[model samples]
Target: MKYKVFVAGSGGIGEAAALLLREWCEFETEIFLGDVSEENLAKAKNFILQNSQKTSVVETILMSKDGTNEAMKSAFESCACLLDCSPGTQAPRMARFACDFKMHYANLTEYVAETDEVIALAKDAETGFVLQTGLAPGFINVLAMSLYRKFVEQFENETIEKVGMKVGALTAHAHQPHFYGFTWSPIGVATEYVKPSRVVRDYEIRQIPALSDRETIIIGGRTYEADLTSGGAADLPDYFRHKAK
Candidate 1:
């Protein structure tokens, strides 16, 4: 059915997501893009309209930190879902608004504390809430689960020794001293690198230093380095706690 979606950010990820929804959604969509900056809102709206199908109905809203503005309130009440692509710190606030409006909520924040807050806020709610729906925390976790399921089916055994999940966002060109370029926020990369990673060790959840378990591996006949980054495991470690080692 045709529905409305309220997107809470106007950054790169926000614009890209809106474009994908408008171009590929099965039903006609009405999207309200909200942000604090007028420049960003205009840019994001124009970007989506230029790339999406002709039937796309895109509008912009000026959002506040507390979500108290009349325009923001109207959009929230109208939309069926809130897609939060804002900064990680804004996760809980957006989640509160979603719960208050009784709309399905989804976000891409990898911040553990913020994610925990969202979980607590929506634990008893009737509507749906999906957290950490980003690349490493989202896609990689799903892929790991799929691989585990396939292995169990083929081997007919549940005593799995190990399930390794890794991800790297490498730049095409690199130099020494760090040998990395920024595809994402530098602060985010640094935060994940230094934070403790949640892992399953000996059928128990353990917190280990990020970048401590570094190794080299070959993929497609080319050698590359891999390491454990914080929050990438998502909820897999918890799910497989007693099921796999």
Candidate 2:
């Protein structure tokens, strides 16, 4: 069946998905609903209309704090997927709702606590909830797994040297600057960035400070500084002990 996807928060990510869906309607149903003020939503809509070659068909909802559950149900009816780009605080609540309602939950959320919570809940529930479904986590995961398999196959007997990954986000457009700008709450962005980061060192999982690893990247005449991210890799310690080296 063609997927009817409901984006739970008509912010930047939601609107992006909506545009992509409109461009690829034969494959998915993209609808954006959120509690953002009407002015914000209208601005989002205008942006879509301006950038998109085709007419953007978006259904909007003004959500209230007291009525989120009902709003979610209403906007989420018949949705094959729920993409939550709401604030970090809302992710856990949305994850629980998705689990309780038997909905597939996907988010671009960066909250380790919330992601961990959802991961725990998924252990008992019959649904799949993915927290890092974009850029760093999503695509990086696929490529990393591939390299992992190759390393295992190629180094079946050799003592592995060191394993590390270099990842980054970039805009294909030269005019656009610095990876991307997601339309999300300032609180969500700040909270995730301010929190400590964790990763797998060898096989051991450990927490690393965020923005601590600064490296320079150059493309043509442009130079930019980037740093390591915190969070993700929660299962490394339980699965392996390669950190002692």
Candidate 3:
């Protein structure tokens, strides 16, 4: 059965997921390559052609924010799964679009509240809504669930004393201007870094600063620093805390 998949972002994340979907699934996958410009759509298309065979690629709608909502409506009505690879703040509208269209939703937003909404969507729906399915959120969620399941299987009743996670993405030959970004989103990065966070302090929810959790460290040959970031805590605590019984 050729399941139809629709993708709504054409930047690094969207394009990458679409390409991988093309590689892995025997489904009819189409990407609505919406960007704020035509060049971006062209670039995404070109990149897709380079990585994937030029078949009837589901369909590519080169619409943007200023672009019409007509195509968005059509796409929402069509695809079985809507995968979002847009900006961190753009998750709600995209996810809402999928929900209104009666389609399954997935995305790579590292924001906790956004992910919470996605999870809430799954409560009454039959479609799959896999939130935070990328590097930190996706893989991290899988691993955490695995460990949670393992512990539950092993001991059944006890409080989980602690959970600590460390994950990051870096580019080679790191530069200071963008530090670790090719296409930098300074505001978004700053917002995340400066966002006040909630952490399990002595087994109780406590507010802490994300970047304030920073520490300098020595690596293989150089020293670097990283602040604690919340990638999976929004929903995991609820899952783990409940299962710790």
Candidate 4:
């Protein structure tokens, strides 16, 4: 059986996901790439088709900011899942659509407020809702939790001292003034910088301003600067509050 999947953005992440699903998903899938921009949707469709290695079908839809487009609604009604790769600000809207359509939902947004809204909306949903599924909050959080679990098992200890999680996606070389190149959404980067970070400090969860604590570190014999950023903690601040400091 071929599953229908809806992708809610045609930008970098969304396009990449569509391509990946087309090429790598175990089950056959039909991907519908939706974006506010027809130009982007066309480009993404071309890219996916050119690079696809499977026989999955790829389609496109024009999604409005409010997500009330009749065409988009028709597409949503057929899909079994919606992968939200749109801006973090749009997560709640996409999640609502998922709920209304009775489809499973997954999102890559690290926006805390929008994520919370989705969580509340999906709490009683029959389908599943996955959020904060990008590298920092998703992968790093899982990796840290696994390591902590292994550490506890290895030492035969029920609790630990401190747990620190950090992640950075950087270019080969960064110049002065932002020290960053635009590999992903600049707006998302700005949002992370301005939002407060949630972390477990002294065995309790606390909110601190982004970049409030800066430190110098050496990785692979290269010295670099690091600081606190928002949304990367995932649920660790709550999960490990009593177990780690």
Residue 62 in model 2: lDDT: 73
Cα lDDT tens digits, model 4, 1-245, are: 78999999999888899999888887899999999999999999999999987867889998887648889889999999999999999888899899999999998877888888999999988899888888988988888889988998899995888888778767889988888977668899898889999888788889999999999989999998899988878777889887887
Scored by TM-score, the top model is 4
Clashing pairs in 3: none
Per-model tally of clashing residue pairs: 0, 3, 0, 0
Q: Model 3 Cα displacement at 188 (Å)? A: 4.3
The full ranking of all candidates by lDDT, starting with the best, is 4, 1, 3, 2
Better-scoring candidate (lDDT), 1 or 3: 1
| Model 1 lDDT tens row, 140-209 | 8888889988988999987788988877767889988788887555666787888899988888899999
What are the RMSD figures for all models against the true structure? 1.8, 4.3, 3.2, 1.5
Segments in model 1 whose C-alpha atoms lie over 4 Å from true places: 174-181
The deviation in Å at residue 73 for candidate 3 is 2.0
TM-score of 3: 0.82
Relative to the true structure, candidate 4 reaches a TM of: 0.95
lDDT, candidates in the order shown: 0.87, 0.64, 0.67, 0.88
Please provide TM-scores, in order, for all candidate models, with all chains considered together.
Answer: 0.93, 0.75, 0.82, 0.95
Residue 60 miss distance in model 4 (angstroms): 0.6
Candidate 3: segments with Cα more than 4 A from true spot: 54-58, 64-68, 120-126, 155-157, 181-188, 215-226, 241-245
